[model samples]
Target: MSVSVGIYSVPLVCEAVPQIGCGCLAKPVLARLEVHPDIAEAWLHHRGDVIAIKWLRELGVDQQVGLLRAALGGDGDSQVALVAAASSSPLLATFPNPSYWYQRETVDQLSQEEAHTIAARLVQRLSQARVPLPDGTALQCDLACALQEVLVVDEAMPIEARLARLLGVARDTFQQHLGSQALSQLDAWLTPAALLPEDAG
Candidate 1:
């Protein structure tokens, strides 16, 4: 039987994007949606209340959504490509642990390259820090995603809903700030400079 979510008849479940407070389709849901016969197009956008059914075709043959966002966020830089590879690679598991080397003369640890890769990914996000979403209001967002998302409402919307949207935006902004700080800490700790310090000062 076909399922319906909110106003759409398509069997789609919207979930919050991790670390960025934006709406994202759950992967399993997307895997199902990808093959749905009724769906002419399915776009897994980083924002929007529902997945953009028309956006899928824009992804083209190389339609891995993560790579698309990585390219966009990094401005098509090679460094972003490297970081994207590491994010998907299981090889990251093999990287040595991070710890103090003062106690031991020699310690096994991640290479500088590996550390940089990790550091880059730690700060990586699926979308820009903030996006304006027209609140039709793009599915229900009780807890919201972890990033900064601004909700724009039609003038006709009720004041209560508008106020609610404003509050949601405020929460998202705060959450984004905390996420940024945490990622920065991770970046500083795992970057090449931290791992292979020439000055050690």
Candidate 2:
């Protein structure tokens, strides 16, 4: 008997980027739709839907499809590359230190150098991926939104201060708000600003 591995296929439904919400586009525009919960979880975790919509605007449905196709773990190479890249990044590296130190007397957790290094790595990966992101205004907006979600989960800052910097909000703010009602709000708040178009820029 022969065995199979390293073979993958995206449902025809995934061929054209699905319009996120309320567009004049007809339903079932693409064919053979199939979605597994695991894929949905991964997409949700990484805010992949938002990322895909933004990319679709420039690259068109075809290119978006290509990226998604390539993203689906061809020969396990693409999956491994994405996983290695995400795991090796510094943001993930420094994420745990602060959590471990929360109750300790030491206020000094992540160093300025550490912060800068992680930020640089994120930027570098974004650059290396060669993805065309939104302009500064749009990027800033998106970051602000993402940061806000992070703060909601961490809930350590004054709401006023929290609103001031959305994307990449300071680590201090994160530590302060780690346990708050904001987290509850997140569960109920379904549509994130992260999913909005960058047309504001």
Candidate 3:
């Protein structure tokens, strides 16, 4: 007997991207969709409701059709599970762990270089797992370049803009509080006088 792997032959619903609340999943999914327009069209055509449920079931996950439907409809909880499934990440296992939460906070508090190191480790782990990237080589290159730009800080863009991009925040929002928050924090260390030695001549 031959075992089947891949998408099930489910009847199509409507051709439209289902709104999903998990932003993390959204990015990877969109990236994959861009590289594989056929898959994207198939997903949208199926409305994601049946697809999500069927996929989970195939994986032996005890998922509720209603919950999967809610996930496709942008429910936060269900979206998290779906994302975990897609990435082969232990997001669900760690979701309730205080230590995991603390680690995330600690990473956020680390210096840019340190955070970049952590991000690099994550990318390496993903690679080791042999998880299929959304678009393969091109998308991988784009992500690498983006990460490098954020870590190196583009001289052309203002500091606030760079920070905003790294933090995935809006430039306007980053600018609004830049003076009081980032600028003030950097004032002492980054000031020219701090870098220049006192006159000794």
Candidate 2, residue 64: the lDDT equals 43
In Å, residue 24's CA in model 2 sits off its true spot by: 46
The TM-scores of all predictions, comma-separated, are 0.20, 0.18, 0.18
In candidate 3, which residue ranges exceed 4 Å CA deviation? 1-21, 26-51, 55-172, 178-201
Candidate 1 accuracy as TM-score: 0.20
User: How badly does each model clash, as a count of residue pairs?
Assistant: 6, 9, 0
Best by TM-score: 1
Task: Give me candidate 3's TM-score against the actual structure.
Answer: 0.18
**Residue pairs with backbone atoms closer than 3 Å in model 3 (clashes):** none
Q: Which of 2 and 3 is ahead in lDDT?
A: 3
- Report the poorest 10 consecutive residues by lDDT, candidate 2: 22-31
Q: Tell me model 3's lDDT, rounded to 2 decimals.
A: 0.30
Give the Å shift of residue 80 in candidate 3: 14
Give Cα distance to truth, residue 29, candidate 3, Å: 4.1
Task: Sort all candidates by lDDT, best to worst.
Answer: 3, 1, 2
Tens digits of per-residue lDDT, candidate 2, 1-201, equal: 221111112221110112221101111111111132112111111111211111112333344444445443332233321223443354334322433211111211222222233234333433444534334333333333444343323334432343344332532332233334333433232122222232312
| lDDT, residue 50, candidate 1 | 24
Residue 166, candidate 3: C-alpha displacement in angstroms: 4.6
Question: Residue 84 deviation, candidate 1, in Å?
Answer: 35
Question: Compared with the true structure, what per-residue lDDT tens digits does model 3 show for residues 1-201?
Answer: 222122211222211112111122222232333343122221221122222211212334334333333333443333333333443233333332333221212222122323333234333443554543343344334434444445433133433454446444212222333334443333333322221123411
